[model samples]
Target: MTRRRLFVGLMVVALIVCMSTTLFGAASVRRYAYSASNPGGVWYTMCGGIVKLLQEKLPSNIRVDMIASGGSVLNTRRLASGEADLTMAYSTHLWECWNGEGIMKGRPNDNPRIMFEIYKSDHYFVTLANSGIKSMKDLEGKRVVLGPPGSGSSDNSRFTLRTLGINAIESELAFGDAAQALAEGKVHAMGMSGSPAAGLVEVAATRDIYIIPFTDEELDKIVSAGPFFSKGVMPANTYQGQTKDVPVFMFTVYQVASKNVPADDVYEMMKVCFSPEGKEYLGAVHPYWKTMKNDPELVKALGIPYHPGAERFWREQEQKK
Candidate 1:
């Protein structure tokens, strides 16, 4: 009886040792949640590509997961609340969040730090070719879908219309749903931002589309409205039935990290994202990635500070040049 008891006690000790090892191994892997826009949008696709690249390049102990949220405004909130470790937001929105101005007034969130400028998101005002809405002025009484609620695109659309004194009935919808509404004639126009938006491409596939370009005077008013606004051109053939260059007001989209994130991790992420392998992979994922550059001047133009890790990485790049 004594010998049998001894053997059972030894087995119990071994089992506890195995369980402890398993728990420790699981705890050692640090997973970070990255916030981005809803699926079926360019931001969503590009962010997925970035997360995949990070997963492959980052150490096995560090994992990054992408979470789909409303858009820029919500993403910023998430970063400030510690709900997200990284996020994508517009330069205008980031500036407001940092300075406690505009929509972010009285709720300043200074924790967001720029990692890099992702791409130029040009505003697109799309209408069906037969709608007869040839310019921004013509949409005064028309129903317009102004992007999802709390999205940067929505804020931008409202600001542009208000600045130019063009008031239209506005509806907030996701990119895919908005495209469907436009196709069904439920809405007269839709506003979108991003390079070669997937929703616009999908809509153009079935119906002839017209992108209303901003006039020279309108561009001047938009640029004068804020430092974040700039004139941009959408190249000819950017979409089906678009045969000429379309002038548009644009804003920069940036990837930002929380200040709580370790500087070393942010630095490593910048290194992997800017590496030749990373660029090739991202460019293939979307044409927007091709717009990314190593220029620190662009970061400076954001009018906000960079993550220490990102700043360190950029400083090294500057020295190499």
Candidate 2:
């Protein structure tokens, strides 16, 4: 409880320290800030990969600076507030922000526009194997990191917990911090969502960590709660452990852009994404991209209007093929 309270109290301090972030751009160039997640997570790495690609491929007049942020919910706020030009956010987070619900409830942000769906984030409820936390029901009364404050992690955690009738002592710690705490046995489980997520492989390398799969009953409760939730799976061998697939709740992670961004810049960005070489280039950046292609269905799934620039690029791609 001390570590949980301490981490909670540090929110103020973390905010102050996290206020400053790395930005890479030229003074004379047309630059935009992209909000992403912490170092250990996939979003951070994916954003970093795109940052390098944009810097190298886009015309010198444009620059994209990256901000390692809390996670999806915060990224949505940044986009809606004109603080960022583009970001990748969970589909549920985007849906909630657009309709004035979820974490940003009552303050509807109608500005978020979908670019494309990237991959699905499966919720992984991780606890030390010896803890005997074999399922979501086992989490009751235990200390858990319910994901970072204003993140999709926390958003999912709260709803799932409410549905399951379980309330673990929760803290909103970022991926890296929570992983550290878990390693020290400060928390019983760390709830997170990501593809090729952090901590799984690392922690499993030394200690035995078990991933608690969401039961069908829990998945039905989640999906019945809203259209945003879907069933997902963690393939066999995704992490070193028992070899069978695990059932999990799933949602889309997508690239989002604002209606305010200059259309030409957005078009150029989209064009580069599906360019002949880019099609092959992206798969190498993150293994998740292996399944993503220039598919119109990916955009349609988000259920939001697209930025004109992004729409034009996709339309052009369709016309060509």
Candidate 3:
């Protein structure tokens, strides 16, 4: 009876202190700012999932906002300026931004925290069946529809093509606008990087277009060359005339944010994000959520320190293991 009373007294004291801290901390407002590449792309949709999850999990006073930007490079710039709390970034871009390569070009921003790996995006080198371009070598003289300037896919396509030794003239077309260019014969090939069933590929399917497969030698070279590279396949029957899976280069998509954000906020945000209740939310937000099921290994390869809040959430996940 004595011990029980002592335990109860300690619990009461702990609660009182917590309440006092809350009361004192009320003046310290927390505002979370997030950004994504396109206004209506997968990034915004997935961010909506995070927002809803965080809303239910965070303290009532915390504010969360999602903004739109041009692409990963722009998002990285915003993060560097401390303008965003969180954002979606390509793994390749993250590597480049960290190492000052590619579009980052000696302007690396190391002030970001890698929270988690979001998805694996596959590269698609698509063309009409009649275009007569059967391999990467065939694209040398072809007119290619690269993605919009400054978009993540555009950057990936450019670097990938250059690495593969293809030097086709690039047409600055967005994924949504590529079908018309292909149908008009203005371009012989279109380079895209996304999920196997991406909307752009669906559009191409309707027009009897399909992606070409990369050779095993090509896949091996990419994976051995960079931390960002991976192997992915577009399964058989995804696009018109595709009777077998198409091989392609792939890389992780990362959930990231500015390092200056408070650790506590980052923790709760990620807690809600990876919770069982958030699974359905993620699936509804993007089909790529299936890839997130392999998150443990993915997080291990995050290549940067997690935000304090995100680290706490990951620790809790580890406890469950």
C-alpha local distance difference test of each model? 0.87, 0.79, 0.72
Tens-place lDDT per residue, model 1, 222-300, is 9999668899999999999899999999888888999989898999899888999998999998988888765467667
TM-score of each: 0.94, 0.87, 0.80
Deviating ranges (above 4 Å) for candidate 3: 1-29, 39-44, 48-59, 293-302
Q: CA RMSD for every model?
A: 1.8, 14.0, 9.2
Model 3's number of clashes is 1
Candidate 1 wrong stretches, greater than 4 Å? 1-9
Report the lDDT of model 2 for residue 309.
83
Lowest lDDT block of 10, candidate 2: 19-28
Q: Distance (Å) between predicted and true CA of 115, model 3?
A: 1.4
Residue lDDT tens for model 2, 1-321: 999999988997787666543223334468889888776667777888777777778888888889878888889999988898889888888877787877678988878876766776787677888887888988999998988876777778787888888988988887778877887799999887875676556777778777788878888888889556788888878877747788888887888888887788888887777676775777788887655544466556656888888888878878988
Query: Against the hidden true structure, what lDDT does model 1 obtain?
Result: 0.87
